[model samples]
Target chain A: MDVQTWTYLLVIVTFALYIGIAIWSRASSTKDFYVAGGGVSPLANGMATAADWMSAASFISMAGIIAFAGYDGSVYLMGWTGGYVLLALLLAPYLRKFGRFTVPDFIGERYYSKTARIVAVCCALLVSFTYVAGQMRGVGVVFSRFLEVDINTGVVIGMVIVLFYAVLGGMKGITYTQVAQYCVLIFAFMVPAIFISIQMTGNPVPQVGMGATLADGSGTYLLDKLDGLSTELGFAAYTDGTKNMMDVFCITLALMVGTAGLPHVIVRFFTVRRVRDARKSAGLALLFIAILYTTAPAVSVFAKTNLLKTVSGQPYAEMPAWFKNWEKTGLLVFEDKNGDGLIQYVSGPDNELIVDRDIMVLANPEIAALPAWVIALVAAGGLAAALSTAAGLLLVISSAISHDLIKNVLKPEITEKQELWLARGAATIAVVVAGYFGINPPDFVAAVVALAFGLAAASFFPAILLGIFYKRMNSKGAVSGMVVGISLMLFYMLKFKFGLFDGGKEAVDALEADWWWGISPEGFGTLAMVANFATALLVNALTPPPPEHIQNLVEDIRTPEGAPPAGSH
Target chain B: MQLPTEFCRLSGPARMFTFSGHTNPDNMDQPTRQEHATRYWNANLRIMAVLLAIWFAVSFGAGILLREWLDQFRIGGFGLGFWFAQQGSIYVFVLLIFVYVYLMNRLDAKFRFDR
Candidate 1:
C-alpha cells in the first residue's frame, strides 16, 4: 500500500482504539473523574505518566533538535530526565500522601488560605495553556504533512477527539487512553530507529550502534566520521558544544525544576493508590521514558550522518523521490548558486539547500528507505503523543476551574453532581480555547512554551517545596514569594524573548549583549527560583509562624503511613 | 541536614499536637510517638541528601563543569563527558529513583509505618 493509505488506516485504527477505551472507562462521579477512583496500579500509572509527560515536543521535535544542534542539545536531554529524580525523591510521594485532587488543593490546604489557592490556580492555568498550545500546533503540522488536510481542519479534528474523552471520562479516560498512546508512540519511535541502526552499523541497538564502527569495514567509529564530515562542511564538531558553560548550567537546572513543577505531571501521582505506589510509579515512568530518551541521541547521529552523505556536494537533479516530496511541503529547498547544479549544504553563506530541523525525525524512515507502513506509523504516533498530552493539560485547566474555583471557593456548598457537570463544561470550553490557539498560533508559540517551563519553575516549585519541607512556612510568605517569582520571570521573558521593551522580535538577537549576567531568557528561571526561595525565607522569618494544626499537617505528610484514598477528604 | 534538626528544636509548640491521641492505638506516650516520627524524618532526609549529591555530581559536575577534562577519555567511541550528557546521566537518574523507592520502603517497614 501507498504511504498515504497506510497513514489513513493506522490513524483511523488508533483513533478508534482511543475512543473505545474512553467509552469503556467513562467516569461516573467526581472521584472517578478527578483521580481515576484512586485505584490505578503502579505500572499502569507509570505508562500513563510517560505518555502525558512526553508531549509532541519530546516525541517529534527533540531528536530533530539534537540532530541540528549536536552537543548543545545535551541541555534538553539532561534537563528533562533529571527532573524525574526531583519528582520521585522530593515531591511525588508526599503530594500523594496529601491525597489531593489538584496542585492548588495542596497549596490551599497546606498554607490554610484561599488567596494562596487562587494564585496557584492562575499559575497552573497559564502554564498549562502555553504548553497545550504547542501540542495543538504539533497536531496540525503532522496532519497537514501526512493527511493532506488543512492545518485548521487537522486542529479541529484533534480538538474533537480530546474533548470527547476529557469531558466524558476525565482523568480515568485520559489515563487508559494515554496507556494505549504510550504503546503506540514508543513502538512507532523504536521501529524506524532499530531499522536505521541495523542498516548503518550492523548493530540492532541504536545505543550501541551509535558508538560502533561503520558496517562498511572502514574501521571508522560513527562519531569520529560524523565529526570529520561536520568540520569539512564548516560546521562545528559533532561532540563539541559552542554554548558557554554557565548558560548550559542554568538552562539544565531550569528545565529540571520546571519538569517537577508541572501540574499535569504532578496530578498523575494523585491517581495512584499509595505513597509507595507514587514513588514506584515515578520510577517506572522514568524507566519507560528513558527508553526513548536514550535512543534519541543515537537517532540524531544516524539522521545527521545520512543527511550529510546524501546531500552535500551531490547533484540536485539526482536527488531521491523523498527529497521532491518534502520540497513540495516547503520544508526542503534547493537552489543553484554560482550556476552550479550541485547542492552545497555548508553552514556559511553560499549554501544552496535549506533543510528544516523538523524533517530530520519526520522524514527519517523515508531517508533510510524503510517500508511504507513504518512511515505511516510515525504519523499515528505523533498524533497519539499530541492528543494524549493535550488531554492531560486540558484536564488540569478544567479541574482548576471546576474543582478549585467553583466547587471549593465560589460555592463550597455545591453538590457532587453539580461539580461534575461544571467539570465537563469547563473541559469543553478549555478544548475550544486550545483549538483556537492551535489554528491561529501566536508568532511566539515556541518562546511561550519555553517560558511556560520558566513560569512553573519560578512559581510552583518553590511553593510546593517549602510547603512540604518547612513547617514554619505561612500563607503570607508563600503568597508573596509566588507573586515575586512569577512577576520576575514574566519581566525577563518579555524583555529578552519577545523583545517587548527593546523594539520587537527582530531586535531580540541584537539585544543579547544587554542580558543580565549573560543569562538568556530561557535560563532566567533558575535565578527567579533562587529569588523566590530567598524572599520566602526572609518573609517567613519576619512573620509569625504557621499555626499548630498546619505544622501537624506537614508532619503527617512526612510519614508514609495511612495515606487515605484520594478525594476521600 | 542540620536544618531539619534546627526546625525540630524550634517546633516545641508543635509537639502539643500529637498523633498519639488518634493514629497510635498502641497506648504509646506522646513523647515516644513524637520521637519516632522525628527519627523517621531524619532517616529519610539523610537518604535523600546522599542520593541528590550523586544526582548533581553526574549531571552538573561531570557533564558540565568537568566536561572538557573528561573528554580526554573515551568509553567505546563516546567521549566520557558527552556520553554522560546524552545517555549515562539519564540511566543513573532512573537508577536513583528506584533506589530511593527501595530504601524508603525498607525504612517505612523498619519504623512500623508500612501499613
Candidate 2:
C-alpha cells in the first residue's frame, strides 16, 4: 500500500487499540487511578515502564543525535541507559517499599516540612512540563507529515487519545496502552534497523551491523570510514572523543541521576507487589528498553552510511523525492550555499545552510527507498512514543497536584472521589499548557529532553536517594537543596535554551555553541546534582532531624516481606 | 565489599532504621545513632562505588579507551568498540541493575534491613 493509505489504517488501528485498552482498564478508586491498585504484575509493569521511559525523543530524535554526534554520541548511549542502573539499584525498590504514590510524598514526609514538598512539586512540574512539550511536538510532526494535517491538529488528536485512555484508566490504562506502544515502537524501530543493517553489512542484527566492515570490502573499519567521510565533507572526526571531556562526563552523570529521579519512571516500581518484584520489574524494564536503545545507534550508523552513499556528492536538485518531501515540511531544508547545488549535511562552525537534524531518522526509510508502508509505520510509531510519554508525564503532574499538594498537604481529609476529579482536572489543564508549548518547542526535542533531565537531577535525585539511605536528612536540607539545584541548572539552561536568562539563543547558537564551561546543557545536570548533594548535606547538618515516627517509617520501608495471599485485601 | 555484619544486631524495628534511630530522646541514644549512620553510609557508599566502577569501566574503559584495540575485531560490520560504545554499554548497564538488585537484596536480608 501507499504511504498515505498505510498511515490512515495504522493510526486508526492504533487509536482503536488504545481506546479499547482504556475502556478495559478503567480505574475507579483513587488507588486504582494512581497506582493501578498496586497489583500490576512485574512483567506488565516492566512493559509499561519501558514505554513510559522511552519517549518520543528516544524513538525519533536519538538516532538523529547519533547520526550527527557520531563517535562523540557515546555520551547519549552511555548516559541514558546508565541512568536506569542508578534507578534500579539506588532508587526504585526503596521508593517502592516506601509505597507512596509520588516522589514528593517521600520528600515531604521525610523532611517533615511542607516547604520541601512544595519545592519538590515545583521541580517535578517543571521537568515534566518540559518533557511533555517535547512529546507534543513529536506528535505534531508526525501528524503534519503523514496525515497531511496541520501540526496543531495532530497534537490535539494525540492529546485526545491520551486523555481518553489516561483519564478513564489513569496509570492502569496508560500502562497497558504503553505495553502495546512499546511493541509498536520497538518493532517499528528494529525492523528498519535490521533492513538497513542487512543492506549494509549482510547482517540482520543492527548492533552487529553498526561495527561491521564497510561494504565493498573497503578494508577500513566502519567508524574509520565514517570519520573519514565526515572530515572529508568538513565535519569533525566521527570517532574521536573530541569534546571537553569534563563536560561530557558531567552531562552523562547528570542524565543518569536525573533519569533515576524522574517521578514517572520511579512510580512504575510501585505498581509491582513487593520490593523483590520491583527489582525484577526494573531489570526487565531496562531489558525491554534496551531492545530499542541498543538498536538506536546502529540505526544511526546505518542511516548515516546510507546518506553519505546516496546524497553527499550528488546534485541537490537531483536529490530523491523524499528529500523534497521532508524539505517541504521544513524538517529538512537546504540553502544553495555559495550557489552550489550540492548539499553537505555536516556540522559547520558558522555556516547556516541548516537542516533540522531530527529529519535524518524520520526520513530514513524514505531516503533508502523502503516501502511506503514502513514510512507509514514510522509515522505511527512516532505518534505512539510521543503520546505515551506525554500521557505518563501529564499523569505525574496531575497526581502531584491532587495527591501530594491537594490531599496530602492542603486537605488531608479529602475523599477519594473528589481527589480523582481534581487529578483529572489537573491532567486536562496540563495537557492544554503542554499543547501550547508544543506549538513552539523551546528547542529541538532531544535538547529540551536533556534539559528536563538536568532539572530533575538537580532537584529530586539527591533528595530521593538521601531519604532512602540517610536518616539525618531533614526538610530544611531537602527544600534548600532542590531550590538551589533546580534554579542553578535552570539559569544555565535558560541562558542557552532561548533568549531567556543571559545571552540570547543566537549568542550561544554561533559556532562556539558549547555550553557554559564547555558543559553541554544535556550534561550540566551532573554539576547541579553535586551541588544538590553538598547543599542538602550541609543544610541537613545545620537543621534538626525529623520526628521519631518519621524515622521509624523510613526504617520500615527498608525491610521486605513475603507476598501476602491474593484477594485478601 | 564486606559490610559490618553486626550492624543488624538490634532487635525489632531497629533493623528498619538505617542509622541510629531518630534522635528524639525517649529515643535512641547518640552512640547508637552514630554507629548505625556510619554503618548505613558505609554500605551505601560501597554499593555506589561498585556500581560507579562498573559504569566507568563499561563506558570510559571499554567504550572509549579500549575501543581501538577491540575494534581490531568485528561483529558483522561493527567493531567491538563501536558496539560497546553504542550498544554493548547499554546491555551491560541493564545487567548491572539486575546484579545490583540481587546484591542489595542479599545485603538487606543479611542486615534484616530491607522492606
Candidate 3:
C-alpha cells in the first residue's frame, strides 16, 4: 500500500482510540476533571505522565537537536531526566499528601493569600501556553507532510481532536489516552531506530549500535566514523564539544529545575492514591521516559550517519527523491555556492544546502529508505505525542483559569457542575489560541519551549520549593519572588528574541551584544532563579512571620501522617 | 533513618492524639504532637539533603562541571563525560527515586502512617 493510505489508516485508528478513551472516561465532577478522581494507579499514571511530558519536542525534535549540536546536546538529556529525581524526592510526595487539585491551590492555601494564588495562576498559564504552542506546531508539521494538508488546516484539526478529548474527559480521559499514546510513540520511535541500527552495525539495539563498529568490518567505531565524516565536511567533530562550558552548565541547571516545576508534570502526581504512590509513580515515569530519552541519542547517531553517507558528495541531479521532496517544503535550501552541480553537506559560510534541524527526525525514515508503513507509523507517533501533550497542557491552562481563578478565588460559591462547565469552556479557548500560534509560529517552537522552561525555573520552582521545605516562607516573599523572577526572564527573552521595547532594529542590535556575562538567553534563567531565591529569602527575613495557623499548615503538609485519602477531595 | 525509629517509639500510646476520651486519650498533648512533627520533619530533611547532594554531584558535577576532566577517559566509544550526561545521569536519577521510595516507606511503616 501507499504511504499516504497507511498514514491515513494509522492516524485515524489512533485518533479513534483516543476519542473512545475520552468518551469512556468522561468526568462527572470538578475533582474528576482535575485529578482523574485521584484514582489512577501509579503504573498507569506513570505512563500517562510520560506521554504528557514527552510532547512533540521529545518525539520529533530532541533527536534532531542532538543530531546537529552533537556533544553539546547532552544538556537536554541530563537536564530533562534529572528533574524527575527532584520531583520524586522534593515535591511530588508532599504535594500529593497535601491533596490539592491544582498547583495554585497549594500556593493559595499554603501562603494564605489570594494574591499569591493569582500570581501562581498567571505563571502556570504562561508556562503551559508556551508549551502547548510547540505541541500545536508539531501537529501542524506532521499533518502538513503526512496528510498533505496545509499547516493551518492541520493545526485546526489537531485543535478539534484535542478539544473533544480534553473537554469531555478532562484529566481523566487525557490520562488514559496518554497511556495509549505512550505505547504508540515509543513503538514508533524504536522500530525505525532498531531497523537502521541493525542495517548499519549488525546490532538490533540502537543504544548498543551507537558505539559498535560498522557492519562492513571497518574496525572503526560508529562515533569515530561520524567524527571523520563531520571533519571532512568542514563541520566540528561530531563527538567533540563546541559550546562554552558555562553556558552548558547553566542551561542544563535551568532545564532540570524547570522540568520539576512545570505544573502539568506536577499535577500528574495528584492523581495517584497516596504519597507512597506519588513517589512510586515518579520512579515509574523516569523509567518510561528513560526508555525514549536513552534511545534518542542513538537515533540521532543513526540519522546523522545515514544523511552524511547518502547525499554528501552526490551530484544535484542524482539527489534522492526524498531530498527534492524535502526541498519543496522549504525546510531544505540549496545555493550551489561553488557553482558546481555536486552537493556539499558541509558546515561553512559557503555551504551549499541549509537544512533545518527539525528535518532530521522528520526525514529519518526517508533518509534510510524505510518502508511505507514505518513512515506512516512515524507520522502517527508524532501526532499522538503532540496531541497528548497538547491535551495535558490545555488541562493545566483550563484548570488554572476555572479552578484556580474562578472557583477558588473569584466566586467560591459556584456549584461543582458550573466549575466543570467553565473548565471545558476554558479548554476550548486554550485550544483555539494554541492553534493560532501553531499556524503562525512565532519562532522555532522548541526554542519557545526552552523559554517556557526558563520561566518555570525562575518563577514557580523557588516558590514551590520554599513552600514545602521552608516554613518561614510567607505570602509576600513567594508572590514577590514569582513576580520578579518571571518578569526578569520575560524581559531578557523579549529583549533577545522579539526585540521588545528596543526601538527599531539598531537598539535591538546593540542589545544583542549586551547579554550578561556571555550567557545566552536560554541560560539566563538560572541567574534569574538565583535572584528569586535571594529576593524571597531577604523578603521573608524582613517581613513579620506568617501567623500561627499558617505555620501549622506548613507543618501539617510536611508530615506524612494523617494524609487525607487520595480521592477524598 | 533515625526518624523512623523515633516514630516507632513515639507514636505509641503515650504520644497519640485524640479528639475524644478514647484509648490513651488522657496522654494526648500538644507538646507530644509537636515533638513527633519536628522529628518527622527533620528526618525528611536529612533524607532530602543526602539525596539532593548525590543528584547534584552526578548531573552538575560529573555531567557538567567536571565533564572535561572526566572525558579524559572513555567507556566503549563514549567519553565518560558524554556517557554520564546522556545516559548515566538518567539511570542514577531513576535509582535515586527507588531508594527514596524504599526509605520513605520504611519511615511510613515505622510511623504506622502507611495506608
Candidate 4:
C-alpha cells in the first residue's frame, strides 16, 4: 500500500480500538471511573503508566535534544526517569495505602485542613496544564503530518477524540487504551532504530549500534566524528556541557522529584490491588519505559549523523526534496542570510550552520533515506505518546478543579454523579484550552517541559511526602508551604520565560551571569523547596497536632487489613 | 538524628508496654502515633539518601565532573563519559526505579509497615 493508504488504515484501526475500549470499559460508578475498580493487573497498569508517562517530548523531542545537546541532554533522560523511582519507592505505596482518590484528598485529610487541599489542587492544575500544552502541540504535529490537515484543525481533532475517549471510560478506559498505545509507540520507535543500526554498524540492536566503532576501521570514534563536525560548524562539542552547571544540576534534580510527586502518576498506583502490588507495578512500569529510554540515544546519534551527511556542504539548489519541504514551514529554515545559498541551522551569535538538534530525532527516518511508510509510522507514534500524556494531564486538571475544588470545597454535599459530570466537563474544557495554548506555544517548550520538573519538585513533593510520612504535619503548614513554594517558583520561572518583568532575553540571560548568589531560575526551585520544607516544619511545630479525632483517622489509614479500626476518626 | 530509644523498640510487632492512662485492655494508648512518626521519617530519609546518590552520579558525576577523563572510552559514536552523561545515565535511572521498588517492598515488610 501507498504511504498515505497505510497511514489512513492505521489511524482508523487505532481509533476503532480506542472507541471499542471506551465502550467495553465504560465507568459505572465512582470507583470504576476514578481507579479502574482498583483491580487492574500489575502488568497492565505497568503498560498504561508507560503510555501515560512517555509524553510528546519523549517521543518527538528527546532524541533531538539528545542529538544536539550531546552529553548535556542526559539530564532529560535521568531526570525524567529518576522521578519514577522516587514515586515508586517513596510515594506510591503509601499514597495507595491512604486509599485516597487525589493528591489533594491526601493533603486535605492528612493535615485536617480544607485550605491545604485546595492549595494542592491549584498546584496540580498548574503543572498538569503546562504539561498538557506540550502534548497538544505533539498531537497537532502528528495530525498535520499524517492526516494532511492544518495544525489547528489537527488540535481540534485530537481534542474531540480525547474528550470522547476520556469522558466515556474514565480511568478504566484510559488504562487499557494506554496499553495499546504503548505497543504502537514502542514498535514505531524501535523499527527505525533497528533498521538504521543494521545499515550503519552491521548490528541489528540499536544500543550496540550506538557504541559501535567507525566503519572505516580508523582509530577515531563515532562520537569523535560528531564532536569534530559540530565544533567545525561553530557549535559546542556534542559531548560537552555548556549551560550553567548549577542550573542543570538543580533542574535535573527537581524533575526527578517532580516525577515522583505528580498526582496523576501517583493515582495510577491506586488502581493496583495492594501496597506490595503497587511497588511491583512500579518496577514493571519502569521496565516497559526503559525499552524506549535505552533506545532513544541510539536514535539521536543515528539521526544527527545522517542529517549532517545529507545536508552539510550541499548547495542550496542541490538540497534534497525533504529539506525543501521542511524549510517551507521554517522548522528547517535556511537563512542564506549571508547570501551563501547554503543553509546553516546552528545556534546563534556565531553564524553557525548545522541542523536543529530537535529535528535530528523527529525527522530521523527520512534523514536516513528510509521508506516513506516508516516515517509515517513515526508520525503516528509521536501522536500516540503525546495524546496519551495529554489525556493523563488533562484528567488531573479536571479532577483538581471539579473533584478537589468544587466537590471538596464549594459544595461538599454534591452528588457523586454531579461531581463526575463536573470532572468530565472540566476535562473537556481543559483540552480546549490546551489545544489553544498548543497552537502558539510559549517560547521555551523544551525548557517548559523541564520547568515542570522544577514546579513539581518545589510545590507538591514536600507536601505529599510529609502527608504520607510526617503524621504530625498540620494543615496550616501544608497549605502555606504549597502556596509559597508554588507561587515563588512560578514567579521566578515567568520572569525568565516571559521576560515580562525582565524586558528582554538580554536582561534575563544576563541574570544567569549576574543573579543573586549565582542561582539561575531553573535551579531556584531547590530554594523554593527549601522554603516549603522550612515553612511547613515551622508551622507544623507551632500549630497543635491534629485533634485526637484526626490523629485516630491517620492511624486508621496506616493499619493493614484486619487491623482494628482507630475509631470515630 | 538521635531519636528516642522507644523508636527502636517500637520497630517490632505490636506489643503491650504502656506509658499512658491504664493499659487495661487494648494497648491503644501505647504510642502508636509516635512509633509511626519515627518509622515513617526514617524510611523517607533512607529513600532520599539512595535516590540522591544515583541522581548525582548520573548528572553531576557522569555529565560534568568525570566527563573529560571518562571520554577516553568509546561506544559506537558515544564516549563512555558522554554516553553516561546522556544515554547510560538514563538507562541507570530507569533501572534505579526498579531497584528501589524491589528494595522498598522488603523494607516495608521488615518494618511491618505495608499500610
Candidate 5:
C-alpha cells in the first residue's frame, strides 16, 4: 500500500483500540474517575505513567533539537530524566501514603488551610493549561501533516476522542488507553531508529551504532566524522558544547525539579495500591522512559549525519522525492543564492537551505527510504503521544476545578453523584478550552510551554517537598513562598523571553546578553525555587508551627505501613 | 556519617525489646511509639541523603561541572562526560531508585512498619 493508505489504516485502527479500551474500563464512581479506584497494578501504573510523561515533544521534536544543538542538548537529556530520582526517593511514596484524590488535597489538609488549597489549584491549572495547549497543537500538526486534514479539524477530532474517554471513563479509562499508547509509541520510535542504525553503521543497536565506524568501510568513527564535517562547515563540533556552563547547570536543575512536581505524573502514583508499589512503579516508569531517552541522542547522530551527507552541495534538481515532499510542506525551503542551483546547507548567513527541526523524526523513515508502513506508524505514534499526555493534563485541570474548587471550597455538601457529574462537566469544558487553544494558539504558545516547567519548579516543588519533609511548614509560609516564587518566574519569563520590558519578540534575541547571572530565562526556575525555599523557611521561623495533629500526620506518612487505600478517606 | 552506627545500635536493642514481650505495637504508650517513629524516620533520611549525594555526583558533577576535563577520556567513540550526560546518569538513576526501594523495604521490616 501507499503511505497515505497505510497512514489512514493505522490511525483508524489505533484510535479504535484506544476507544475500545476506554469503553472497557469505564469508571463507576468519583474514586474510579479520580484515581482509578486506587487498585492499579504496579506494572500497569508504571506503563501508564511512562505514557503520560513522554509528551508529543519527546516523541517528535527532541531528537531533532538534539541533532541541531549537539552537546548543549545534554541539558534536556539529563534534566528530563533525573527528576525521577527525586520522585522515587523523596516525593512519590509519601504522596501515595497521603492517599488523597488530588495534589491540592494534600496541600489543603497538610497546611490546614483552605487558602493554601486554592493557591495550589490555581498553580495546577496554570501549569497544566500552558502545557496542554502545546500538546493539542502537536496533535493538530500531526493530523494535518499525516491525515491531510485542516489543523482545526484535526484538533476537533483529537478533542472528541479525548472527551469520549476522559469525560466518561475518567482516570480508569485514561490509564488503560495510555498503556496501549506506550506500546504504540515505543515500537514506532524504535523500528525506524534500528533500521537507520544498521544502514549507517552496520550495528543494530542505535546506541552502539552511533559510536561505531561507518558501514561503508571508512574506518573512521561516526562521531569523529561528524565532528570533522561540522568544523569544516564552521559549526561547533558534535561533541563540544557552546552554551555557558552555568546556564546548562540551572536549566537541568529546573527541569528535574519541575518533572518531580508535575501534577499529572504525581497523580499517577496515587492510582497504585501501596507505598512500595509507588516506589517500584517510579523505577519501572523510568526504565521504560530511558529506553527512548537513551536512544534519542543516537538517533540525533544518525539523522544529522544522514542529512549532511545527502543534501550538502547536492543539486536541488537531483534531490530525493522525500526532500521535495517536505519542501512542499513549507518546512524545508531552498533558495538559489547567487543564482547557483547547488544547495548550500551551511551554518551561517550564506546557507541556502532552511530545515525545520521537527522534520528529523517526522521525515526520518522517508529520508532513509524505509517501507511506507513505517512512515505511517510514526504518524500514529505522534498522535498517541500527544493524545495520551493531553488526556492526563485534562484530568488534572478538571480535578483542580471540580474537586479542589467547587467541591472542597465552594460547596462541601454536594453528593458524590453530583460531584462525579461536576467532574465530567469540568472535563468537557477543559477539553473545549484546550481545543480552542490548539486551533487558535496565541503567538506565545510555543515560547510559554517551556515556562510551564519553570512555573511548576517555582511554585509546586518547594511547597510539596516542604509539606512532606518538614513537619513545621505552616500554611502562611507555603502561601508566601509560592506567591513569591511564581511571581518571580513570571516576571523573568516575560521580561526576557517575551521581551515585555524592552521590546517585543523581535528584540528578545538581542536581550540575551543582559541575562541575570548569565542564566537564560529557561533556567531562572532554579533561582526562583531557591528563593521560595528561603522565603518559606524565613516565614516559618516567624509563624507558629503547625498544629500537633499535623506533625502527627507527617509522622504517619513517613511510615510505609498503614497507608489507607488511596481515596478511602 | 554517624547515623548508620547509631541506627544499628538503636535497632539492635529495639528488636530485642520487641521480641521479649511487646510484639503488639498498638498497645505501646504514646512516647514509646513516637520514639519508634523517630528512629524509622531518621533511618529513612540517612538513606535519602546518601542516595541523593550519589545522584548529584553523577549528573551534576561528572555530567556538567567536570565535563571538559572528563571529555579527554573516551569510551568507545563517546567522551566519558558526554556519555554520562546523555546515557550513564539515566541508567544510574534507574538503579538508584531500585536500591532505595530495596533498602527502604528492609528498613520497614526492621521497624515493624511493613504492611
Candidate 6:
C-alpha cells in the first residue's frame, strides 16, 4: 500500500480503538473520572503511566535532539528517566496514602489553607498548558506529514479527537486507551531502530549496535567513526560535548526535579489500588519507560551516522527525496554557499544548512530507505504519543479548574453532575487554547514546553517536598516560596527567552557575559528551585509551626496503616 | 559514619519486631506504636539517604563532575563517563527503584504495616 493510505489506516485504527475504550469505560462518577475507580492493577497502571509520561517529545523528538546534540543530549536521557527514581522512592506512595483526588487537594488539606490550594492549582494549570501546547504541535507535525493536511487543520483534528475521549472517559478511559497506546508506540519506535541497527552494525539490538563495530569490515567502532566524522566537519566529537559542564549539570537537575513534580505524572499513581501498589506501579512504569529511554540513545547514534554519511559533501541536486520533502516543511533548509552545488552539514556559525532537530526522527525511516508501512507506523506512533500525553495533561488542567477552583474553592455546594460538566467544559476550553498555540506556536513548541519542567521544578517541587517531609512547613512558607520561585524563573525566561522587559530600547541578551554564573535560562530553574528551598526553610523557621492537627495529618500520611481504601473519596 | 557493630545493635529489634496491631492490640500501645513508627521512619530515611547518595554519585559524579577523570577508562567501546551518562546510570536507577521497593516492603512487614 501507499504511505498515505497506510498512515490513514493505522491512525484511524488507533483512533477507533481509543474511542471504543472511551465508550466502554465511560466514567459514571467522580471516582472513575479522576482515578479510574482506583482499581487499576499495578501492571496496567504502570503501562498507562508509561504512555502518559512519554509524550511526543520522548517518542518523536528526543532521539532526534540527541542525534544532533551529541553527548550534551545525555542530560535529557538521564534527567528524564532519573526523576522516576525520586518519584517511586519519595512522592508516589506518600501521595497515594494521602488519598486525594488531585494535587491541589493534598496541598490544601495538608497546609489547611485555601490559598495554598489556589497556588497549587495555578501552578498545575500553568505547567500542564505549557506541556499540552507542545503535544498539540507534535500532533500537527505528524498530521501534516502523513495526512498531507495543513498544520492548522491538523491541530483542529487533533483537538476534536482529544475532546471526544477526554470529555467522555476522563481518567478511566484515558488510562486503558493509554495502555494500547504504549504497545503501539513502543512497537513503532523499536522496529525501525532494530532495522537500522542491523543495517549499520549487523546487530539487531540497537543498544548493542550503538557500541558494536561497523558491518563494513572496519575494525573501528560505530561511535569512533561518528566521533571522527563530526570533528572532521568542525563539530564537537559525538562522544564528547561542547556545552559547559555546569550548565549540563544544572539542566539535568532541573529536568529531574521537574519530572518528579509534574502534576499529570504524579497523579497517575493515584489510580492504583493501594499505597504499596502505587510504589510497585512506579517501578513498573520506570521499567516500561526505560524500554524506550534506553533505546533512544542507540537510535540517536544510528540516525546521526546515517545522516552524516548521506548528506555531507554530497551534491545537493542528488540528495534523497526525503531531504527535499523535509525541506518543504521548513525543518530542513539548504543553501549552496560558496556557489558550489555540494551540501555541507557543518557546525560553524556560517553553516549553509539549518536543520531542526525534530525532523531527524520523523524523517528517519525515509533516510534509511525503509518501507511504506514502517513509515506509516511511525506516524501512528507519533500521534499515539501526542494524543495520550495531551489527554493526560488536559485531564490535569480540567481537574485543576473543576476540582480545585470550582468545586473546592468557588462552589462547594455544586452537585456531582455539575462538577463533571464543569470538568468537561474546562477540558474543551483547554483543547481550543492548546490548538491555537499549536497553530501559532510561541517559538519552537518544544523549547516552550521545556519551560514547563523548569516551572514545575521551581514552583512545585520544593512546596510538595517540604509539605511531606517537614511537619512545621506552613501554608505561608509554601505560598511565598512558590510565588518567589515561579517569579524568578519567569523573569529569567522572559528576559532571556522572549527578550521582554528590557529597559526602554537597549537590547540585552541574557546569554552574554553577564549571564548568572554562566548558566543558561534553561538551567536557571535549578537556581530558582534552590532559592525556593532556602526561602521556605527560612520562612518556616521564622513563623509558628503548623497546628497540632495538621502535624498529625502529616504523620498519618507517613504510615500506610489506617489508610482509607482507594476510591473512597 | 557509625560502626557496623553500632548499626547492627541499633537495628536489631527494629528489624525483628513483628507485632501485628490487630492480632495483638495490648502488646502494642500508643507509645510503643509511636516509638516503632519513629524508628521505622528513621530507618526509612537512612536507607533513602544512602540510596540517594549512590544515585548522586553515579549520575552527577561519574557522569558530570568527575567525568574527565572517569573518561580515562573505557568499557566495551565507550568512555566510562559517557556510558554512565547515557546508559549505565539509567540501568542503575531502575535497579535502585527495585531495591528501594524490596527494602521498604521488608521494613513495612517488620512494622506490621504491610497489607
Q: Report the poorest 10 consecutive residues by lDDT, candidate 5 chain A.
A: A338-347
Error of 6 at B75 (Å): 1.9
- Candidate 5 local lDDT, A413-503, one digit each (tens): 9999999999999999999999999999998888788888889999999999999899999989999999999999999999999888897
Report the backbone clash tally of model 3.
0
Docking class of 6: medium
* DockQ scores for all predicted structures: 0.76, 0.38, 0.68, 0.40, 0.72, 0.61
Evaluate chain B of model 4: give its TM-score. 0.63
lDDT tens per residue, model 6, A347-406: 886578888888778888899999999999999999999999999999999999999999
Q: In candidate 4, which residue pairs get closer than 3 Å at backbone N, Cα or C atoms, i.e. clash?
A: A211-B75, A211-B76, A212-B76, A223-B77, A344-A353
* B42: Cα error in model 6, Å: 1.2
Question: How far off is residue B95 in model 4, in Å?
Answer: 3.6
**lDDT score for residue B3 of model 1:** 16
Taking all chains together, each candidate's TM-score versus the true structure is 0.96, 0.89, 0.95, 0.89, 0.96, 0.95
- Candidate 3 chain A, poorest ten consecutive residues by summed lDDT: A504-513
Tens digits of lDDT, candidate 3, A1-569:
99999999999999999999999999998888999998899999999999999989999989999999998998899989998998998899989988988889888888899999999999999999989998998899999988999988999999999999999999999999999999999999989989899988999988888888888887788988999999988888887778888888888989989999999999999998778999999999999999899989999988999888887888889888889888988988987878788888877676787878778888898899999999899999999899999999999999999989998788989998899999999998999999999999976466678889899999989999999888888989988888899999988888876677777434655785778877878888899999899888889998988888888877887777667754354
Candidate 5 local lDDT, residue A257: 96
Per-model CA lDDT versus the true structure: 0.93, 0.78, 0.87, 0.75, 0.91, 0.87
lDDT of 4 by residue, A422-531 (tens): 87888778878888888888767756766776787888899888776676877888788888888888888877655658786557665555554666666677778888
Error of 6 at A123 (Å): 0.8
Which candidate ranks first by DockQ, i.e. highest? 1
What range of 10 consecutive residues in model 2 chain A has the weakest lDDT sum?
A560-569
* Deviation of model 4 at A502, angstroms: 2.9
> Which residue pairs overlap in candidate 5's backbone?
none
lDDT of 2 by residue, A1-569 (tens): 78999999999998899999999999897777888888899888888898898888888888888888876788777877888888877777777767768888778877778888888888888888878888888898889988999988888888888878888898888889999998888878877777777777777987776777766676665666777887887887766557776666686778778888898888888777887888889889989988888888878877887778777757787988887888798876577666667766656743434657677778898887788888888888888888888888989999999988999789989888999989888888888888888887655555667788899999899888888778767778878888888888887776766647555667667524656677776777888888989998998898789788888767655555443322121
Model 6: CA > 4 A from native = A503-510, A566-569, B1-31
Better of 3 and 6 by DockQ: 3
